[model samples]
Target chain A: MGISMENGLSTNKSVGKQSVLFQNPPCVLGYSSIAGKKEGEGPLGSCFDIIEEDPLAGGKSWEDAESRLQKKAAELAIQKASLQPKDIRYLIAGDLLGQLIATSFGIVDLEIPMFGVYGACSTMGESISIAAMLIDGGFADKVIALTSSHFAGAEKQFRFPLDYGNQRPLAATWTVTGSGAVILGSPKEVKKLPEDTNPTIHITGITTGKVMDYGIKDSMNMGACMAPAAADVIFHNLSDFDRKPDYYDKIITGDLGYVGADILKDIMKEKGYDISKNHMDCGVEIFSKETQDTHSGGSGCGCSAITLTGYVFKKMIQREWKKVLFVPTGALLSTVSFNEGNSVPGIAHGVVIEIME
Target chain B: MGISMENGLSTNKSVGKQSVLFQNPPCVLGYSSIAGKKEGEGPLGSCFDIIEEDPLAGGKSWEDAESRLQKKAAELAIQKASLQPKDIRYLIAGDLLGQLIATSFGIVDLEIPMFGVYGACSTMGESISIAAMLIDGGFADKVIALTSSHFAGAEKQFRFPLDYGNQRPLAATWTVTGSGAVILGSPKEVKKLPEDTNPTIHITGITTGKVMDYGIKDSMNMGACMAPAAADVIFHNLSDFDRKPDYYDKIITGDLGYVGADILKDIMKEKGYDISKNHMDCGVEIFSKETQDTHSGGSGCGCSAITLTGYVFKKMIQREWKKVLFVPTGALLSTVSFNEGNSVPGIAHGVVIEIME
Candidate 1:
């Protein structure tokens, strides 16, 4: 019913990504943080030190909190990108609010063009995917993709109150406490990438899922709702591209955790395809259930975003891995629907990440 | 500080638009559909009217509503532009969710190269501006920009009840109910635009906004927050580029109404500039407060969005106005900060639109 090549996928991952690194290597030129709370090791390695304990979330008024977080993220991101605030061509961001106030309010200070987007907790992937394409497609010289969610704050609007004694669901994703942003740009004046390398981390294709309800619904859980969308993209990528599960070293889904990942695999196989090999998920890994007790697993727009920026890409650049598919999954279920007897629906998008050869 | 154009003046006008015939120019092309609610009038003006009723505030479900709205908007936008959806090289859209969902889920049914983007409410402007640049830059043959909002669905998440007996500040604005989608391409193809002239929407330049609060106190009133950004760009356009507001027939701010518009005017004056001769705000006009009972005025990422597609650009083509400045304003407040008690900060992007003479 949609775009189809031979088998039926809409994206191309066969391009030699190694060659992209030199010309459009899709490098994260700038990385910065105006953090609210640093939980896992201070530097993300020590998993213990409180790198900085600035408290914008608690003390600031609602509007101030939104501005502070966005400003913090923007300052760090712009500095990292080394572009004047006005030099940025676009700012693509979203937040967990009724109007995306935090991201938009914050951008007022950055003075860069912006395109506010939303996809719930899966926003990081959506943001990065678009930003990468903007750079790759030459629509922009540099772009930024960002998303954030507040734990205590969002819990009230999205589902239950943190102070509520309700039982948590197995597919519940832990909302992230802080935000992260990155600057995307071509291999402009700064240095040299392999002149003729194919690009890595380019968003080659996209598939949006229908918000389907199966009748079994939960508010706190999102992985289940997002499974079908993940499967749709993964299956489409393989089927349309005529690739096998092992074509890449990894096929990772953003914030799907253990439950959602398993459901996605089952769904894909149910349609007579297998994506089991090297399949990975971000949600299942971030939190130590034993230590953190994030019921099913940690979930947030950041769960996938931070890992991709902090761990996945860095590891890829370090040559620990060659190719991986990053798919951020989001549940399209809102609180009203849950209260209205509607089961949640899910959608996901996939991007291939490879180290420059 | 955040945008500082607010002089706290009000300029309310009840003048109805000049009786004008609605026309779709040929430089545009392509159409697609979402869940079914559809975009625009859908060849019949009935849909947009329906959405205009009992509009959502927040915490409403968009899964069902957006599907119909986005799909219809895409279909008509493409149809109005006189191009087929299959021919579009890219579809860029995003909102306050994580998956950039409406466009993603809505676009999945349409076959085309797609890139989802998010930049909060400034999304539509940012998307269209990028598309115009791409067409002018020759990176794309055709691009689509789409966005929509549901009043019932949104109200459930953002604020208390419309009946909750809460008072809205003067700077508050209402979100528009309809989805706005645009198709951009070379004026040469399909001879869609007039044969003698190039398209009027060739983007010459775009300026982004930043995150600044200047201690904006109310999250609900965004026009107040974002007015400064609008002024910053208008001033920059005048001083930085040595251009004046009169270079265009009219200068449009995406959605600032009586409050923000007044603020923008004052901000420009302080900056030793002026744009009052032909300044207009889409937010104030898109929805009729006399009819809609919208207190302060219209707001939302899509407020300025539909105005550009449905109102301003139309006026530009008819020669009622020419050489326009599109500054889509966005309030960077979220439900979290509204809860946090943060004042909303806002941003606006300026994209000059002119047909090749």
Candidate 2:
């Protein structure tokens, strides 16, 4: 009855209403990214660890292809961390599939304790936030946060089939066929890291997002659907930490695409915070409009995931950016829900990653 | 780089592996359960808050009905806690639908921060484990862990349509048409509880489960598929805590029906710990085999959820059970994976709850 000290940790890290400030930040020991052929042709192709030309990758189905991508990414992540899969205590992962089929079928062989999470495209941020909390809370020594998505697989499930060959609207973004896995380790585990490598980047804080529905019914325009949520989290983080837009090198949103990015800027401006000068969207950064022919940009669980594991993580390791807020936005709607005339709801989770110099 | 104490908490609660011994356990302040009419006729029917005679609940679709169940359960939980929807910081919920439609559409009106999770039938356990962690880690002062399932909705999605009237196999369990929600709060919040209420129950510890594939390919026999994983977590909990089966008044497995219960006991027996005497399965407890026509028993996310919120919590409050080990097992497979001849993998999450005098 006296504070119930039986099993609770003695810490007061809860900052505001919906954010946590980790006392002992979990370090990103290593990360891996696997992209499909189309993603390989994108601007960040050279940044990915592996790019398989064959979407099927010898598998019989598109779902299997996605599973293979998740496996490769997880394996590569473990290998980079110089730790076996058994050394990692947990695998927090999900995919853009019903029941998280890609994750279940993909990383099943690892046999690590898993917490299957779903935040749509915001899965990467959600996974990392949960993993960091577990590590910082002393629940795990090392955890792998991973997520994946494939174009054919996502399209068939979320939209039209390939055989239909329906023309997509200009506001639609292509699902990035890729997977990304990041290994988060405790401070003790980070000390055991190889001396030859640069200083590890730590996940210092996280702000969990809520489902924000702006009454957008068009599933194709996910960017527009998700912008408000992204703006909401961005505002909360800035207010919670009492920091301005320039507090970090960049304020990155997951897959808002071109259309959603503009909407986010407008929303932020209305909140008295103008982040347009230093804002970047993973969806917009992954593809080139002139060559890729993607109508809007790239969007999926993998859009933010691969971009972070490949482009953002590398930049941090090289000290190009000291601190950044990574917010992955998700459109929470299903085909059945859309068919039933339900509006798409959006969610965005924010993670603050910084290099400990 | 000295532990990066900036914005980090100070505590170490992780014990051995795959488990966390909360130093200051989070208390379950309030809870609510809503079951369909079919469930109302079951053994624990009288314990539920609302029992709707119509499965449709005046909704247009089965999916809408499931959503209504979730919304009602969550609303009732908040009301029981003497709080409004805005008072809750986060809502962690999930279901067995594609993209978690029930949770999204159902809880959209509450507009709280949400983390949609999926562990098949084990979602209840997963959500509670996560919510407890968030509270113990000082991430949220009050968080609601909820999940739901509908017999009609699940059958249509996982099996054939109701119109087909296809005969189900003996091993297939009936999906419970219900929803359960538990509000977990920090100690400070628990002190504000109604004076006449009994002492709050606390989540003492948790052991996360790994996906264990025993090469089970039959989805209908979910108990058989999930038994091994259930055994793995049970054994880990016993080993990690160094306690025998008698350590708790009841060792509850979520919904491994008649067949799966035997499998779990057998698996535990092989590990030198026999739980045969104290074991009770929620699936088997909710129904009277002779009267309820449910083949094996009740199963689904709601099966364990409603059982805990309705029957189990009541017993704990009455001091009928001093301690409990609630392990919810999930068969991690999808219709697409099953059709592709893939084997089903199983997972289980264990949470230890106790009442302190």
Candidate 3:
């Protein structure tokens, strides 16, 4: 469908059912990823911009620590882009905390017009989609998309307290303690790369996901809960664009660990898409099963966020991976809802990022 | 600042600072407001579309009840719009719950691509702003903007359990149990009102807000916690458009009750705008101060939402109010944050609604 503006500009941005194809793709001017000590020791540890050895991040509490991490990442991203806080038109951010307290406290000091979003771990994708659309839609010149998660905070909020010494199932994934932020800009604000040899990254399109519930109720097995959602959106993204899985260099899922990764491939196979060869999961890549002993893998909003900003972007800038489909999956369940015996539904958002030559 | 599109259309949607002035405003296709028993007994009782006497809304738990309330409102709004769920391109909705369980569970059945947003109780305004922008930007033809808050559910999540029979502070505002949903559509989908005499309602502009903190720690006195934020946005909305208090038929606030209302007026007065005569609050209007015994007034995401869709929209249709600046204020505090001795910050979002000739 095409919409003709009163000014006589007819633009068709809506793609297929759930995707948006930007007419003027928004450029990723700057990006930053701050990781905790544990994530810094992971395989991709060296890619993080800042690695904080202190879990508290010099803050009073776990939530405060998470907030500090987010603030640091946001500031670094803006500084990298050579823009002040006032130059950012909007701050689209969120976390795993209730009421988005982490974001409310973290970005309050920055004082940018804010929009708090929550989609469990998929927040990074959601924020990027909204920010890109806002820029492409002629609403703003520059916008910040950010998200974070803390191990202690997520455990206290979602599962048992750390002091309780609770036992986790093999399917459980560890929440990554980190924050990632990116500054997206309009064409006018886009500057040439610091290194002329580097390729510019642009958010070309996005596919928003529907809540998919297969009636999975386990909070511990978040990957199992979120895997269906990941498969559904990946299928839709491919179908919406009428392309095969080989169209992109890589298709990455946010945190579908070892078990859920297998489930995701099975689901995709049933849907007639063979993504096995090029599929990758951030959860599986962040930690080594033999060395780290993490049952499933690393997971959280920060999982995919830092992976994309720190690792994937590096590959794209170096011309290793030219086009990528980044899909972040989220399990929608609160302690209250989980205890109430409600099913853990899942949602995933897909962002199409490609190197602009 | 104006953006010149590749299609040769130069549109200046950004107003002063944090506001956006839509070149092609989106129309409100339909709206629904569902209230609980307590709200049904209030002054705006007859205005609500449906009043569920059972706090559970026939669900087993408080969270489930709130989810059911949201589902009912969303369905009703779509039905009123003469559209199926399939017609909605996106659903921007959230509730005052951890992980937004209410929204996650409520709208899952709708099968629409979703974007969950949270701004405490100011979520209604945020959702509407996003939905309108998507429509105006040609990213979506129709979008559903929704939010809900339930007294019992909120009490459990943010305060004490209902069984505790906690003492009510005189300064405390009662959380309203209600849900409100509105379907915004592009001009191409604009249909004439059922009544030929009724004018069409359009979202003309929006003022997104920044998180404001004054170190207010009293959750019971949320009016004080949110008043400054409300004042900041109202001041910016007026300044951004270069308008005075008289420019709007009424300057309406979301849930700033008696205490916050006074504070808001005082702040605005100091800011060089005397809005004493035209200032109205949804919380103050929802209930009778003398008889209802709701200490300050009814306050929640639902407070401003229902008031707008029910009472405020009726008045606009009757020509009693031709233009309104609707601001929904939110005190950003979770039980965890409050327990941790963190300060309660606030945020508010403003939407400009006017009758189109």
Candidate 4:
């Protein structure tokens, strides 16, 4: 990767399209994942840094609980990086809520300058992408990317209240109650961990997704609404980088679940790239369908976030996967839009993470 | 503004605390503001690019109307910049809506890579801050910072439904029905207009704000809720840059109405800075308290946004005000948060706009 520099600034970070190849890749200094009771009982339960047994997270409301989850994850991530909140220059965060109430309340105590982003469930990817760009672009030395979602709160906001006892269709996915926080720093700022024998993870590049609307009006089947966007970003990420599917050890999608995952593979195949072999989805990997009864799998901002911070990062640190393209898909819809007969649009952001050489 | 370079990369963009003084300042190429009939009748009505008399903007719902407002402003801004939607690298946008449905649906037609941001009414500042950073950091050549707010939609979302005929408190401000879009580009990318000659406006520096909660639970009195935040950022910007308030020709706040403006001035005075001589509030400027019947003043993301794009930019181009510190303040609250007895927190971002020398 040749960096065309004039004076003291790199002029060519933008790739073919919808992607940025960082000249100075930002490293993931530390990360923490906090999960709820149901998530703690899932297959990747043990991977989480902290698991709250109480559904309300010792709070009065579900939104407050999610806020607590986010606060805990942020603090733990900072502690893991051996840094304080004051040391972080910026905090990029958002959640799937009206006006991002959860995020506004959650990270307020951290007192870091924040850029609130909304990409539905894809918020984690968006946050990380912005954080990496800020670091690589020399705007900040260290930044924290954070996001969270709550099952009960999401249901109340997007669907019926718990007292209504509404039945979900098979295509409806459960919103994961969890939060994930990652502390990213410039390569020079991150301290090399001597105790860890594996490799450090660096965000080498990113592919930002546009709003893709296939006119899918059914909010229950978010996988269908988001599959097209997931596919679009994934296709472009490969095309823009001129890389083959085999180039990466794993191509991970946030919460495509069983249905959207198949659709994504088919879409990629049509685009002449076969990602089926290496394709993995956090939704499908998070829980057991038979035991958990999570029909379409866990879906939310936390779905991919916790999976990445808890499960995937552990695997990467153990040298299981060398390179990964992590794509988080989001179904952009609100009760107001849906009630107004608006179609559910979807957006996805892709982050390229690789082990340092 | 000496930039210390390490291998052709500026490493000293970060200023004293929360501010970033850009070495290569990004220039504002073009801007557009779309206002509804009510805003069109306001004091700055003539400055708007377009005014839609129809409340719906030919759309069925208020949300759709707001989305249309965003779309029109974006397209017009691109056209004003003498570029197409394809020419822009990224779209930084958000609205005062749940899940940012307006933004998601509004700019989807533009098909640019988008980053949805939320800072309540302070979103214009947040979006522009990120957009300027992207250009200054060399991640993008051109970007559009966009935001919108609808009176009816906000009334329903935040306070009371319009149909309820709810009585408003004297301290309450009216939500502005408008949208503002600004096209910012690398100084090298923006084309100079020979037809008209004036100093080009450049985003020289930015001071990002942290969430400040004074435990003010009154949603109706948002002016009181956001004043502290507005004061905090202004103080930091002046302190970080080591300048007095008089360094700026005018210190402009987004929508801190008459109430908040007084509080902000008092706060600044308490901090050993008297800005009353050169302070201005968009809320107070946009409407007439006596004739408009607006209790406190105008408020919303669009209040400050349209004021900046339509009125302030025009004044700057006319050489009326040379340098200005534009601070947009946001009161972070949700209906749930308010109902749950949680206090409304405030955040504000400051952008220093100066005439290029």
Tens digits of per-residue lDDT for model 4 on B167-214? 888889999999999988888775554322222899999999999999
- How many angstroms is residue A192 displaced in model 4 relative to the true structure, after the best TM-score fit? 4.8
- The pairs that clash in candidate 3 are none
Error of 2 at A344 (Å): 1.2
Worst 10 residues of 1 chain B by lDDT: B13-22
User: What digit string (tens of lDDT, one per residue) describes model 1 on residues A273-332?
Assistant: 777878878777666667676766756665666666556665565567777777777766
- All candidates in order of DockQ, best leading: 4, 3, 2, 1
lDDT at B79, model 4: 80
Tens-place lDDT digits, model 1, residues B1-357: 111121111111100110000112124443222211222322323323233332221224454455456667777776655556666665776554433444545565675545455555677766775565445433445678777765544454566665676776666666556677877665555454432222554555555455456677765666677788778767655543456668878888877777888888998878876788889887667555565556667666566666666666556657787677788776655565655555666666667666544
Reference-based lDDT, residue B143, model 4: 89
DockQ of 1: 0.20
The RMSD of every model to the true structure, in order and in angstroms, is 8.5, 4.5, 3.3, 2.9
Query: Per-residue lDDT tens digits of candidate 3, residues A1-357?
Result: 242232211238888778888898888888999998989999999998899999999999999999999999999998887778888899999999999988899999999999999999999999999999999999888899999999999999988999999888999999999999988888667655455213278999998999988999988888889999999889878887888999999999999999899999999999999999999999999887888978999999999999999999999988899899999889997888888888899999999999987
The numbered model that scores best in lDDT is: 3
Local distance difference test, candidate 2: 0.87
- List clash counts for every candidate, in order: 116, 11, 0, 0
- Per lDDT, what order, best first? 3, 4, 2, 1
Q: What is the Å distance of residue B184 in model 1 from its true position?
A: 2.2
Error of 2 at B70 (Å): 1.2
lDDT of 2 by residue, A120-196 (tens): 99999999998998888777778899999999999989999999989989999999999999998887765555542
| TM-scores of the candidates in the order shown | 0.77, 0.95, 0.96, 0.97
Model 3: residue B218 alpha-carbon error in angstroms: 0.3
